[model samples]
Target chain A: MLPEPAVAAGKATRGWIDPRVRLAAALVYSGATAVWQKPESIAAALGFALGLAVFFRLAPGPVLRRLFAVNGLLALLWLILPFSLPGETLLQLGPLAASREGLLLALRITLKSNALLLALLALVAPLPFPSAGHALHRLGVPGKFVQLLLLTWRYLALLEQEFGRLRRAAALRGFRPRTDLHTYRTFAWLLGMLLVRAVDRAERVRRAMLCRGFQGVFFSLQEFRLNGRSLGFAAAVAAAVAACAVLEFGG
Target chain B: MHISEGVLSGPVLLAGAALAAAGTGVGLKKLAPDQIARTAMLAGAFFVASLVHVPLGPTSVHLLLNGLVGLLLGWPAFPAILVGLILQAVFFQFGGLTALGVNTLIMALPAVIGYGLFSRFLKGPRAGALAAAFGCGFLAVLLGGVVAGLALTFSGEHFLNVALALILAHLPVMILEGGMTALCVGFLRRVQPGLLPGRPSVEVR
Candidate 1:
């Protein structure tokens, strides 16, 4: 069996807001983004999320990688939204006429989504999965739910390695993926074999943990303490989001 | 496809979250202590499965296999899927935290349906198991996309196009998953036949 891998956690950024606080703040800010319909307000929310993204000191490389993954749905939005919405026609693309209202709606969605994504990146991505699990636990999330998340994160890398070995063995056997029944069957069999191996391995692990006094509850050695600075930051975030909603809706 | 953050309105988000929470509640209750490790293993598998992509039309899409998940595990599929989605949200930002509830509902509700369909039909005969697996795999994603698309359509005034695009884009995935699921059932039926639901007396792979 492989040793318990020392998966390095994210660097602890001192003087930053508490992760629990940030989690709460992100939730509040995202909720506000969902509710506020005024396009300007959504843009402002994006600005707020962007500022947090900067403050979080996130690297542009990881941020862009995330953006690329999400842009597929946004790409679909761009394709469909511009032509299907009702209002004054802005232009024509072959058989489709782009509407001004549709374009603006699409813009609003883009801003809202991008901003929320940035906000979450700042709020959640900086912490490793386990630490985030800690935050969720601290926020009164169910113990079982957090436990599940932690377990999945813990064994995911091991599972991936197992998957790699199986794929290589298949490749060694001259099995290549293509658009045919043979390709489909080979992949399916491979995945099925992986699942069987993982399940058997898990059974062994469970018995080991049981023998070693594993309990249903997880006890963490590190605890999160909320300080004055964290409280202050949460308050400031709340105030900014409220101000944005009021301005966009009332102004 | 996972609906990204901020696209859904407040009401839609709330509804999705509520439904997901309810599902999770039932799932937790139904799950046995012995099954926790198995669920985690499958959840881990589902989480990494996203990295395996299939070419579909112009752009490529990844395998979710929520159907296979549900068919094997029953109600536990909800939390398994939720855990996987949370990891994706954190690691790739494919979906946002606020939209977690909606994403869970979109993906797992269909899994629940697939479980019912598969369990009812999977144990009969080889041909029947293959067909059931194919249907489960294909319709699971197809229905999930439709659920999400309807949510998008109702969230705002001008979202019909978004709904149409989501439904249409996922059609290819539906067919792909069906074929994959059929093949997988065949493979599993031969090898680790115990993983599948049926009589103990069966032939070898």
Candidate 2:
């Protein structure tokens, strides 16, 4: 696996807050309260979001960039929700009826989603993927699946490079995507070629693997150590989760 | 787009996790010892596929290539997808650990099915690649939306509306994915023709 910020941390310590851990924590936190009918749930969600924002150190930039990129378009639903959803109208502007309840609901959903995103990105951004996979495997994810992940993680980098080369080669050949129908056909043909190449590469890779040892299973070199920091991270997360649960229960 | 944990009910996520485990078992059972290296490499490819996001409309979606994986690897996709999704969540925060099962089923099943069905539709390696690549990507997203809709419905949220909105949003995404798949397949054919599943190749001189 390519050396990444997350991988470096994972190699240093086995029990690190990989992106998956953060994402899972965020998802569970949000999913639990997604369906709550009470306004208290929304308040709790807002609090959780605020807590995550603080703890995760989610800066305004990357968070906004990702949100703008992923959910910016979906935000259009805000307009639709207010007018179409059934509830008391907050405002009457010409033909549009803005429902107070629908607007509140939309606001809650947006806040919840954004919070989840912030928490996940903050938590997962530091760890490498393979280390995270190993963590999951240790947590009882099947070995076979873990193997697949390790392999995918390794091969994807090479393949992506191959893809970059192909794209460059095509561009040099004057293969523009939008010039005409023929260009489109050429583009199609390029994709067909990429698939065939990926498979061929797979065969060579298999052969290379056999020449090395002929045995199945790839081993990761990094060793995991559960030290004070890991326990601390885990404990902190548990406390946060418990706090949320308590808030939910109390409210 | 991947969902996080706590986004759904505990029972639902657990159920999905169980199903994912079963699916992983089946994938493992199907894989031969010799195929492990190839399987791993393909899984890596699948994992990286998502990192390259192609812009479509206001939102951007990356390639899944599960169909291509399924077409090339067959039942091995189960384990492969499991790996890819795990990595995505870990490396990219695309999904969550609890949401892994739902994410896997959402993307991988369609890959397995599309590769199975479309492999027969095309005549040659290029066609097979096109069919598998496009079908896998487009169908995977559609399946994902369906799953998302179902999850929302199960939660007593608005299923149909969400489904419609998601499915509609994904139409252009499908086209973009299809185009990329075709290109990837085409290049593969020129450089390494033997890689495509079920294709007999003349030895490259």
Candidate 3:
């Protein structure tokens, strides 16, 4: 089975911030960090992300685990960029001389990646997935797209269970995956079966929705209003992001 | 392959976002109201299928299957793939918010291209159909890597080597996906040809 939804596990400590505000803040904070080039500003952005994580009451164990996962690609960049980038030499490892500019670029990427990811974990991960989709719809994302997002979220776990059952059946039938044509073919057939079943199930689902006189729009009972506190939270996030931008571009 | 957050420069990110928005707009237009459930269902299946790890020589790689997605959904692969990546960012945190546009483009564009190039061949002879499916799978990942590399290189000249290495690294995956796609398509052709794009439901024996 897939891991439990992070929001469910962290629900006890979830902040009272509106999902819309958290989403917008996460976007602004991530966008700010993305464009930031100055080390001072990027480091400050990371610090802000850390502070947000603490304020959101995200468990450090899960936060760090996510951080390490995101850093895997960064670690690869650290290995390649420092040696391949042409600049003033920082360290000579035999024929490959690590450039100072390359090291700086790598370091900047590392900091920026962590900052954006931590911000996402803190600001975005706490919202239940359906609420995020509704928040997106409220924020003017097209209704059709939001519907697709919600539906996909709805079926992801079911199809994951279906896939698991098929794999288990295969394993029961002595299917041990190896580096061979048979393995790839077997996996492909398994996937093909899943798709076929999904399409069949889709037909049933469509009919059921039609039977209930479903329309193009999905109605939700819960409504999100931007209360005073949520607006205040938005202002604080905007100010923090603006401060980082000023640090990078301000004279 | 997803380009991580904060690595792409502003111009690249902006360009990617603009293109992805355009693509998604067109795709949404093509998606009829009735097809929403079907599209979402297929997208969910693709999302789960992508989590499947197949063995390589000494390691394993998750299946991309973008080719099959494209072949099945045509233009709608854009929104489907976007939704998949969004779910990925939300649940797993594999890719982040900032890079969503580029990542969507990287995976979805090739999917559309694969559909355009290979869907017609699917109704042909078995050998040709399988061969075309193989091409689709191979070309999708190949193109995905190329676009990712371009995204990186455009971000900075320093990323050229990284770009090249990324493309080179995808070679094995291309072969694996190509073979799997061919087999998968063959299976579908036999069992449920109607599931394939542009095929008539009467073809379902």
Give the number of the best model, judged by TM-score.
3
What would the per-residue lDDT of candidate 2 be over residues B144-179, giving only the tens digit for each residue?
A: 667767765675354358667777877776666666
The TM-score that candidate 1 achieves is 0.91
- Deviating ranges (above 4 Å) for candidate 2: A1-60, A67-74, A179-181, A211-214, A218-221, B1-18, B43-66, B86-99, B118-145, B168-205
Local accuracy by lDDT, each model: 0.79, 0.62, 0.87
Candidate 1: where are CA atoms >4 Å away?
A1-12, A68-76, A92-96, B55-60, B197-205
> Residue-wise lDDT of candidate 3 within A79-186, one digit each (tens)?
988887888998998899999988898899999998988888878876877888888888789999998999988988999999899999999999999999899888
Query: Which regions of candidate 3 fall more than 4 Å away from where they truly are?
Result: A7-9, A12-15, B200-204
Q: TM-score for all predictions?
A: 0.91, 0.75, 0.96
Please provide, for model 2 over A104-153, each residue's C-alpha lDDT reduced to its tens digit, 9 standing for 90 to 100.
76676565555555555555555455666676576566665666666666
Candidate number with the higher DockQ (1 or 2) = 1
Task: Order the candidates by TM-score, highest first.
Answer: 3, 1, 2
lDDT of 1 by residue, A1-251 (tens): 22121111124344357878987998899888888888889888888888886776666776776677667668877777778777899898788899998788778888888888888777766665577788888888877777777887888889989888988898898876666677667777778888888789879978987898877766665578898999998998999898887977795
Best by DockQ: 3
Considering just the first chain, candidate 2 attains a TM-score of 0.78
**By summed lDDT, which 10 consecutive residues of candidate 3 chain A come out lowest?**
A7-16
In candidate 3 the C-alpha lDDT for residue A152 amounts to 87
